[model samples]
Target: MDAPACAATAAQAASLQALLNTYLREMAPGSAVLADDRSTVEIPLSHIPARLRVRITYFSATGPHRFGPAQILFDGSSTWHSAPPVQVLTLIAQECFTRLNSRDAGQLPEFLRGLFNSNAGIEQNLIRHAGTPEPDGFLAAEQALTFGHWLHPTPKSRDGLTTWQQAAYAPEYAGEFRLTFFAADQSLVTLGSAHQAPADMLRQIPGLDGAFRLRPDEVMIPAHPLQAQMLRLDPQVQALLATGRLRDLGEAGCAFNATSSLRTLYAPGCRWMLKFSVPVRLTNSLRVTKHNELETGVLMARLLKHLDADGPRFRILNDPAYLTLTLPGRSESGFEVIFRENPFAGTDGTGIYNLAALTADPLPGRTALLTRLIQQLAADHGETPADTARLWFEAYLTCMLDPVLDLYDRHGIALEAHQQNSLLDLSTGLPSRGYYRDNQGYFIAQDALPRLNALEPSLTQQPALVYPRAHINERMAYYLVVNQIFAVIRRLGCDGLAPEPDLLLQLRRRLTTAASRLSGAGADFARYLLTAPALSAKANLLTRARNVDELETEAQEGLFLQMPNPIAAAQPQPVQERTDVLT
Candidate 1:
């Protein structure tokens, strides 16, 4: 048998870049030193008590940086030598454990395991699919994320799925398979629907009636095939199946494709997207649909209608219904399923791309999808790519940013509009419409309780929906500004379509204008973005080190650190008279 090769490939280099980027943004800001020209950077591994140096290929003000292989000098060493990504991970983990005062850093093993799995997944994806032209369609774009979150250490890691399962179930592999179904007795099932009955809606899936039969007294529950396998092993579930209280209908539906979030399955012919709770762990959380999340989905749908939340060019794909099985002694029976609105059905979904998929760093030797789209638009419009990018970006801000701020300003609703949850319609080769989706990402300001209560009296029932104004502001600053907008700027700059500083200037001007016209939380948040020297960003590395399940933690509890605000740097002038408003 041959020993596993240790050579650093593209996968390893990418992993290294992600880890270093997270460290610099959320952990090393005050401790690390950079050269005047930013040609090189020195990072201090305080726990290991070593100094690491690396050549900066690209220094992004928005935190996505490119660096050469690293070199480290130990406390007693007089020379610096090469260090691999795994070595860097170890030192960073040590630093986190020490700084966090962890008595038992048991999650380190799991973290390392995920890194290995992620590397293997990336290698396989590159070998099989890199440089291939992106497929056309909503589902194809969802599966285009071969290399996952660029800032995550284990972006492709899935703890519970075997290689065969991944081939059949993972979006990256473009797996399209039948959904696993079960018919549970009505007494043992819970169905919540805001508009249409969930079970009735499930029956409406094309060819679903032919696939399986449901008894008059039974309700159908659909799940990710992987989740079905795990549930069959659950002792409580096994008891129910053995007693004939629940009958496993097996994989019976028409082909369904896994979306970007692995557990969410989509079938274009179907009117709804089914989000399930899988046993597998993805990145920071175990992908389970919490009970509160199910209720929130139904509640939020009604609330949106009451608030008339849908803007002219922006809207949310609401989760209006859900179904799950009730198992004794368990709050969640591993059967929680959410029915999300599917606006992108068949031809209607064409040219609509999730913002993350559009901005994701492309495989080696290939241009980014966003860059390609902009270049094509430039050619069609007889203009330079830079000019097209500016125009496209302005449209994106109006369609996406303006609506989000308006929601917060008028209703105190702060959406978790991170890239993955954001979508854009580029049917004309530029963003024409923006969509935000996710039942679990809505955050309402507690200060607006009286106003919201009057709008939707049910608001008092969902106490978890409201959060402190400051908390919502912090999240908006990160999700809306740092994660979503900054990603767009980074994509344009790195792809050579436009300069990042130029985009940042554009963003600052837009926010300044918004502040002058907006009121309450929205104006305050916009002003903060325009003037604050530093912005809060989630610490993905530290979160992993602590093994925090992001879904389980409060919005304010997630690990966060301050980083230099790119918008502030682009326009250093103290809040001047508002003159950049766009009519």
Candidate 2:
């Protein structure tokens, strides 16, 4: 390659190295060696034993940094060469497989390819987003995530999607298309909901016509285009088509754009967002809606409705309805679709942003939406950014943390409130309301099972939906604290908007205050959070290295590594405090 091409390659490799370094720090802390000043880090290659080491400049421990080209060291000297990110990851995976004496090493290449493809998709998405006219409120926020997860090895990896398919279906690519419709006989369809049936909602879509003639006992439903193609090849679907039990009505209705969750589609005019079950491998799982998930959605809606008779502190985007066809000899329907209530429907200019997207880096030459919002808030309040950050962080706690803890402490409902699953309704650039989505992620404590069953008797029969208090608390610690809240703090520090130590202090104080107000298992969990020496961090790279299916694996079964607790490290003392501690 020429000089300019070589420089470009080195820069690309550095970007990948930065991503890998972040993942290693979070998931495999043993691999990193930090300097006393916390200004430099050396990561030894696990696959190559001690033959090579990756050295880079480090800023705050948990915040994003300005990483230069990773230097390749051979023996004890610099080789003056840089390894591409995929090469580094491949070496790590090879080492892991060798150490475990496992036979799944073959899967690493496929994952590497997916990672490369994902990077290309991200690059293209950013270019597209920059060139296109800026979309309005929620849509703009939703499409802003050029890079998905900072800690995941391949956050945007989609193995099954072709180039055209990614352009049409990936949320980051701003994909918009009408859903493919399918008609199933009433007897062969399973429907459940808190309000109108799935069939009724489908029949009411305005300007939807020419798909098929719906019989009195038949109903129309939507399917993802890719998933619809897969279903056509199924023997059962073929038999149903031959028997006139199911009809391929083709694509019809208004175009709905893909959300951050690629399988979920949002149409501004529709009353509900449609989440379909796509069999494509996205991130760590095949995006398929299980039978239990459909049932759990209805159950959770009823429970939340019963609990929040007056009004709820946090809004739950209820999965009110689902439609799926029942094929003979099939254990579960893979074409299931969940109809989630659209909270942003007919909005009065209240901007709702997915918390994850808001925190992500904006396109080139643009500030992050959250950072810009904070600056605007500071300008309005005549305060510094730090002061506004503190205020905004506090209000965010009241809106998010308070309600999440209340649900767990009082109701034994543990929401998987990761960054992506949580939404913030911003009023004047500060969080005024919070919404938690994803019915498949709810975990009801066993103690609350009886109460939940009292509301919906069928819940007891769903063994996969409930767990012990300890298990629920563990999940809560990882999702709510480690992934969601800490991510926000990291972003603030990375952008120089707020010092991480100060933010950690504020977080600890808020948790302490909330703990004092709670009782029983919730209080116990709160105390644990404040006092625990280390929190469990998800081992995404290690999990992917092992070729595990995340959706099928139990939460406990997922790989975890101990990450030093920033809250504990940030505890204030009577004497003058030092801010050099890395957490």
Best by TM-score: 1
138-162 per-residue lDDT for model 2 (tens digits): 7666776777775766666777787
Tens digit of per-residue lDDT, candidate 1, span 249-326: 987767998999999989989988899999888888888888888998988898888888997689999999999987
Error of 1 at 533 (Å): 2.6
lDDT of each: 0.83, 0.73
How many clashes (backbone N, Cα, C below 3 Å) per candidate?
Answer: 0, 0
Query: Which consecutive 10 residues in model 2 have the weakest lDDT in total?
Result: 574-583
* TM-score per candidate: 0.93, 0.91
Look at candidate 1 and give me any clashing residue pairs.
none
True-structure RMSD, every candidate: 3.4, 4.3
Candidate 1 off by > 4 Å:
1-8, 46-50, 74-79, 84-107, 554-557, 572-583
